[model samples]
Target: MSTTQNSGRWPHEAPPAGQDRWSWRPQLLSELPLIRRELRRSLVADTSDAAAEQEEELHERLVLLMDELLSNALRHGRAPVAGLVRRTASSWLLVVSDAAATVPPHPDPDRDPARGGLGLRMVADLTTAYGWCSDGGRKHVWAVLAPA
Candidate 1:
């Protein structure tokens, strides 16, 4: 039902091959908080010099980004949603996948700002790079956050 074109490789940049990768499959929306907690722990476990305030800020940003993508998959895309974070030396690749392989992500251009449909644009602004791809009957939406 979405008008978005089926551009399998939007932006055409591939996710990096990182030194480490963490992934989770959340079947319910209520599992987000726990997932976020685990993700935060993995992200900051090695950064001993990170200030408390900076850590908190990073947590907030991670929650916002993850929530937006996962919620979209839960609401619009098919189930069995998975979240992946690949950590390289200086960057992190965040990817969310759902079974809706044929349905591409649609960024509504005409939605009212007050009504809350601009999440895709917000994701684009927050990430250094972003794109989507369809592989193995799953649609993967990804973003790269550098200076990880």
Candidate 2:
């Protein structure tokens, strides 16, 4: 079984003064493992005592959500492009950038089972909320998880 320790809230002091309170940029699939590790570390480092159990469950859910989001991006978002995942004071955002300008169709529960289109539905269920945006040449699909 996986174990986790509660680290309080994310440190507001990590970023230099006057820097964007938020961090953002494009990311690659190869960076996902490291991102997961950093997210856990950030949680542990931020929380105080008495948060271990809560953190553990939150971490578990976050991992599963991340896996689902990334998998959907790779399998359906189309194009081998970069993405962005950001953590803010209130929520964790998973952003997958792709070349497709078309918005993803809403999950159809009635579609034929053999067509294989349940990933986003799972993502929608797992996350606190999710949506997508397009700009210039890229489409960004994002989901948010409330802070633990």
Q: What does candidate 1's lDDT look like per residue over 46-109, in tens digits?
A: 4566465566665567667877888788888998899887776766677889999878777766
TM-score of predicted structure 2: 0.62
TM, every model: 0.81, 0.62
Give the winner by lDDT.
1
- Quickly count the clashes in candidate 2: 6
Q: Model 2's lDDT to the true fold?
A: 0.57
Provide the lDDT at 103 for model 1. Answer: 85
lDDT of 1: 0.74
- Once fitted onto the true fold, the runs of candidate 2 whose alpha carbons sit more than 4 angstroms away are 1-49, 103-106, 112-116
Score each candidate by Cα lDDT: 0.74, 0.57
Q: Report the lDDT tens digits of candidate 2 across residue range 35-141.
A: 56765676577566687767677666766666566655666666765545466666666666677756552566566768887666666656665666677877766
Per-residue error (Å), model 2, residue 108: 1.9
